[model samples]
Target: MPTAPAAEPVPSVPSPLIRAFPTAPPPDGLPAERESTAPAATGPASPGGDAARTAAPAVEDDADAARRAARAPGRREQRYQETRARIVDAAADLFADRGFDAVSVVEIAKRAGVVEKTVFNHFPMKEGLVFDADPPMREALLDAVRKRPSGESVSAAAGSFVVAAVGLLGAPEAAEGVARMARVIRGSRTLQVREREILGELTDSLAGLIAEETRAWPGQVEPWLAAHAVLGLYASLLELARDRVLAGVTGPELSGELRRQGRRGLALLQFGLAGYAKRR
Candidate 1:
């Protein structure tokens, strides 16, 4: 042979997680060790005649860590909810101090001590932050309807629950939160849409529950009509309460008014009570 070409040396890589630990080669997705000493050894110890060198042990991998974190059953959801709550809390502070339109995602992120991407990841839009309605009302309605005495009508059950809720939530302290919410909704068209969307979702869910009571599927008109009829009363009464809240009503006064009006409407609409409380 006239001439032989020289082999190029491969570049060394660094460890992924640990900086200077003498761990073994990383599994896939993890970075490699920097500056290996194996190349410095002389020709594999001359076929092991001098000594047989052992290979390094396997080490922890970044990919394995990621998999473990993702595999946790409820942890990911819990983290997500915590992040959302943080973003909402931050947005509330900014939106209260400066109007909703005045505050930007960057400002919210800065206040929350999170990145801008995190803010958007929790709330798709600013409106979403305002209308993140984790409604206890929904659960209460469902429970009241389901747990009511066998002869009681759904309307009566739901109406009684509403009155109780007003008493519980209509404390003078609760007015500030409700007023803040009303201000945010009134300030933005998008927030109005979000409010409607959340309301519609609750309506549909209630319809499903009502349908269950009637032993009918979702598409049946009986349950849909019943749910809408009940919700209409709720919506009207709720609007009346909202107006009072915005007008500086609070404490037992607002709650008593709500209970009075809510019950009056419900009492009139009880109609036939689904023949549940019929006289034999």
Candidate 2:
């Protein structure tokens, strides 16, 4: 009988929400700041081959050190994310319990088991903890538009992103968290203003992307118009989530409603709004 071969291991994929960005490569031949000003191994070999024996181990040590250095950034990033999640979770809990304005950043830092400066390092503004996930989402949404398949309209690409996002809220835990966040946002005027500002920023960014892709001339309204339509769908979906969550809808019921409404909203954008709400 012949022995069987071992199975190959599978590579791990990153979660969609917390994908890591690429770090810059380390500089060649040791960093100037870390390395000493010692001369290279250019002189002739020493008597008794002393330098040769020592040089081999030194080179080996350098290689080992380089390997460790290469892995350090990944470890650092993991720790950073872990700390950030702790802070955000603490803030969410506190905000849900005592309202957003009632909970101080100091209390959040204490609950998260980190110093105040550490909290500030992860989130420049207190509001940032509530919307920590926004930056990655913005990137993903824009990437969907930029990398849409041939023959796919921009609305379809943006719509797919929103629908998929809504699908993630199908989980009970996610729905609950969203409900909490929505309640917190409703209670705070600052949050409402921030939300509107974020929407405006997203609209501007999408408009700029559309203008670049379509090569629209200066003062072109088409790109801005299209951008507003797409982002308006996004805003509508957000409001739907807030409404459904508050209504005690959870799990599939909440997500299904969102996805269905999202599709219908996208259809409206695709087909134009001329026939909508006309007197009949």
Candidate 3:
């Protein structure tokens, strides 16, 4: 009789977090006021650098110019995009004033000067109104990847986008709109779900980009791992941003602190986690 040996189960790698879970959390921990402000770092991820740059930013379709710049858009396609823009804009204004749930698709159509069916045709659901930023956001990420520095890792380019995003949020013109929108989203569960769905889509899109960078196939392990890790970091960073706003942080204070922490996080990611547990 032959003796059989027991097989060992493989352990999965642990997911990383900005801070360990069940702890006090980042928002409660960030200093309410930064002592001083430093200039944003220049990198492939930043908006633009002073040095002679090599990467070309992604060229996205401008809402007003897309149809015209599309090299002779068909009448139907042109009109369709234009209508969708109107619906999105009208929905934004109305939703901002009355709140997400209080507004109806019919009212949105009325405000947009279109039929309800047109709204449905473009959006398929009311929650889409809250997600108009998805297209632009996705395009921004794509630009970061496409225009990343020649030697930088794809992950670093992504991290740079987060840094740039914080700076953009710090702008005086954007502060109120951002804070107001944050309040509105916090008030609506449906919009929260839509936002999560968008986040997932973005993760998938980024995964695709990572895979392409390495010439890997869909569902391949490398792209999938990198995508999840970076996107998960992005999720945490964003949640920290939201939490800070709720905690009464405002303006450049919020943006500066976030950008600082964001860059620090990216550095740790780039440097690799060695002896992290043994640290005091």
Q: Report lDDT per candidate.
A: 0.60, 0.67, 0.60
In candidate 2, where is summed lDDT lowest over 10 consecutive residues? Answer: 4-13
Once fitted onto the true fold, the runs of candidate 1 whose alpha carbons sit more than 4 angstroms away are 1-84, 217-219, 272-280
In candidate 3, residue 262 scores what lDDT? Answer: 72
Off by over 4 Å in 2: 1-70, 273-280
Each model's TM-score?
Answer: 0.65, 0.71, 0.61
- 1 or 3, which is superior by TM-score? 1
Q: Over all chains combined, what TM-score does candidate 3 have?
A: 0.61
Model 2 C-alpha lDDT per residue in residues 134-217, reported as the tens digit of each score: 645677778877876666666666666766665555557666566777788889998788878877777888878878887789
**What residue pairs clash in candidate 2, if any at all?**
none
Best by lDDT: 2
Worst 10 residues of 1 by lDDT: 13-22
Q: Candidates ranked by TM-score, best first? A: 2, 1, 3
Best by TM-score: 2
lDDT (tens digit, per residue) of candidate 1 on 54-172: 32111233444555566665556656656666677777877767767888999989877799999887777776666544454676577767877766666666656555554433567
